[model samples]
Target: MNLSFFDQFASPSLMGIPLIIIAMMFPALLLIHQDNRWITNRLSTIQSWLLHMITKQLMIPLNKKGHKWSLILMSLMMLLLTINLLGLLPYTFTPTTQLSMNMALALPLWMATLLTGLRNQPSISLGHLLPEGTPTPLIPALILIETTSLLIRPLALGVRLTANLTAGHLLIQLISTATIALLPIMPTVSILTSLILLLLTMLEIAVAMIQAYVFVLLLSLYLQENI
Candidate 1:
């Protein structure tokens, strides 16, 4: 619950980010180093195959016209996604839980949406963003509402990740403290709490993946709708 400086530096960032960025890149580098050998073969190919499947499933749209741009987006998504899930391990820190980290990811997408929208349709970019059809008299009110909602994307993204990770970590901390306190006669509760924490850990993994995907999906859709 505490955003202490000691805890922040507990996971030292090479350049103000988690080491997981480097960790995640290892698999990608391995695939290249092996000359895509990981993709071939049969028995020892499941994990690589799954990674390929995920990359393909998510990278479909990105593979189109702006391939390089797509690569950038997918890379960020994959890297963040890996970090989110892997940080659930014992003695690990989830960077996404930090506001600075979350803002680092969200702000770029927000700016991209705005820039792309303007680039694609400069004629009435800002004006037309207020829904296509509305009562003429409510023009000012409608524009205000639409503008507020549009600007909220980054805020929503940051809050969603921070809230989820903080809540998950808090629950784990509470359970751990409870188990320690009950280690006397009610040893069974400690065991039960450990099991529950394990279950929640697994759920956290899924939530991590889902949150990354949702962020990327929403970003792509935002671009598509506006641009």
Candidate 2:
């Protein structure tokens, strides 16, 4: 009875008011706890462990200059990871599914990385636009092309996250609809389809975790190069 499959991606609201504020606030669920004790709860322990492992991995390639970003990068990862997983639940709204939200997440950090590079190493950063030993004939073209590619990175990041989550959600909705529709006419087929849906849901969970990691990982790499 919905108007469209795309309706789920719409900014869920009540009585003409948008729920983006609530959606943004939902990541607080990942806070786990704020206890300050000798022994931590298991949930807090797991959260700390995950953050430590990810930070260690990302810091391996980065020098001390880039190490300052560990907390910021990890926070973004946890926020995206929590939101993506929460959205998989029935009747949940996913702000990350929107290009604007993803772009907002991507742009400032990307700009930070770019600005850091430009500020710390102007010659090297500008040098990236043109490789060494370029012939004079292609100098203009190469710089223009590389500059275009550089500017497009944030757009690519935003689109990639949005498209992956949106596609997965759409597929889940379509299959779920089919499963319900088949229940009355074809119970056996419906059961099989539901099994497939279960597997797909598991895959989506993995995808959610991965996309979050990749988003942060790429940013770390960006910061690594600049620092």
Candidate 3:
């Protein structure tokens, strides 16, 4: 009732201290490892298995040089996954919903892949701008289009991630708020809305997990192209 719908997206702060920093650190703190032994707990075992599966899948198309990125890619995946899922809780900010943060994440990584290609295979990299056997008249236009697309990759990445997460969060909030308001007036309809809200919550959970994977998967694909 207090904060406007959009205001909820604003970074939370207290006493002039920005708590978004703590929100960013929360996931890392939760991920800290405190146990090391031959016989690990079931939770640790499952965590290891999940990471192994993800790393193997991401590496399938990568060569030896690209394999060096598996660790960083996997860590990024885990961090995004943790923060996204955590943000689904009662009161927490989803940092990934912010365009600035997503862009910061996308730009440098995309640039790295682009630079890697230019450094290792300049001919092929620049050659991607123009395809072979193009009609003479269309050559200029095709090259311009391809170059624009290549430059737009990072913007697409950041916007895609931020938009999807923001839309899902907004939908959930709208539905939940309606359910609460309707409860006092119409109990039966409220119950129905609540059920829908439950299902949507489950779907948002899947979206959170999938979007994180997609973010990493796309980066790996970009890496694949470059390497």
Better of 1 and 3 by TM-score: 3
Q: Tally clashing residue pairs in candidate 3.
A: 0
Please provide, for model 1 over 68-173, each residue's C-alpha lDDT reduced to its tens digit, 9 standing for 90 to 100: 3566667677767777776777776777777777888888977887787688776566766566778899988988888888888888888888888777777777
Candidate 2 per-residue lDDT, tens place, 57-111, comes to 9889999989898889988988899899999999899899999999999999999
Model 1 error, position 117 (Å): 1.7
How does candidate 2 fare on TM-score?
A: 0.95
**What order do candidates take by TM-score, descending?**
3, 2, 1
The alpha-carbon deviation from the true structure for residue 161 of candidate 3, after best TM-score superposition, in angstroms, is 0.9
Question: Positional deviation of 152 in candidate 2, in angstroms?
Answer: 0.2
Give the clashing pairs for model 1. Answer: none
Give per-candidate clash totals: 0, 0, 0
Give the Cα-based TM-score of candidate 1 against the true structure. 0.77
lDDT score of residue 32 within candidate 3: 39
lDDT of 3: 0.91
Report lDDT (CA) for all predictions: 0.70, 0.91, 0.91
Best by TM-score: 3
